[model samples]
Target: MPGRLKLYHNPQSRAVTAHWMLEEAGADYDLVPVEFREDGTRDPKILAVNPMGKVPTLVLEDGTVVTEVPAILAWVADAYPEKNLAPAPGSPERGSYYRWLFFVGSCFEPALIERMMRQDAEPLPKMMVGWSSYDDVIDTVEGALKGREFLVGDHCTAADVYMGAGLWWGGMFKGPRILESEIIQGYIARLAERPAFQRAMGG
Candidate 1:
């Protein structure tokens, strides 16, 4: 049996990704909603659980706290193997799982943030920049998503939950560059159909 799990979340935030993961993993958990002040400060009660004051923080029965969206999603997958939301440890597919999961946080996120903020005017050397270029990151993801349903294997895993949420948000709010990409739009549409995704969105 799994430990008692509680998820601190804000519906408008990235916590939705973890919510989808929990639903996908079939994990019974409680959702603690956190509200942000107009000044952008989080509730102090939540800050006690996550100093960063971020949503998507997971607290186990032993009070082991887990932060970060990707990390939380990864843990849920492994914690509920019966859901088949990830490849087994030490398998080749697991390598793909780890690669894309980390890439979303390390590479894709920075790239998207840079593009959305229009901070690309100052070009840094490839070595100095972790994400390199926005276009490069987009191309890499497009290549991986092409002719495929999920990031790791034929089945949708936690990686898709993370990456799909980012893609869907980007296309919805980022700009025409993302919205114009048929592959991405189509992929997001497919992800939106999943019951887990719908439930997380409060549908």
Candidate 2:
């Protein structure tokens, strides 16, 4: 087993997703809070390990630094297999698991940012962008959740932690068509009911 992990987190940031994953995996870890400066600079301690100065930066016992949210969730799930947070290695379910995890960063995030942050700007050509458009992204997610209780297989996986967090955060900010979609709202409610999610939320 690996030694205790270190997670630099900030409640106001996406680090909350990693924190939730840690609780779900029941991993032995330390939460090192990184507070930002008024001028938007980060502490040297965080910059030393991850010059990107991003929260949710995880350092393993061997000092391997894992940045990015999906990578962290994937690592923790595989590290603690007994938790059943992931599917069997070669199963189709595992393939679906990886898909949704990657989808969040690849499709959902950029599309969301373009939609929310660039409302006054011209819509980027669908053929020119990776996510195509925010409407397409939302439609894809809604289609995925049509008859599914979770993103992959019957039980919740690390993908749920990432996806659910994104949706929940989006809805909180009133992301277009997110809160209005019954399917998305239902999925968020289910994930919010999880004990791990609740604990991460400081409930």
Which structure among the candidates has the greatest TM-score?
2
Candidate 2 on 79-144: residue-level lDDT in tens?
999989999999999999999999999999899888889999999999999889899999999999
Candidate 2: C-alpha RMSD to true structure equals: 1.0
Instruction: Give the alpha-carbon lDDT of every model.
Output: 0.86, 0.92
Q: Which pairs of residues clash in candidate 2, taking residues 3 or more apart in a chain or in different chains?
A: none
Q: Return the TM-score for each candidate structure.
A: 0.94, 0.97
Best candidate, lDDT: 2
Q: Candidate 2 lDDT (Cα, whole model)?
A: 0.92
For model 1 the local lDDT of residue 122 reads: 69
Evaluate model 1: give its TM-score: 0.94
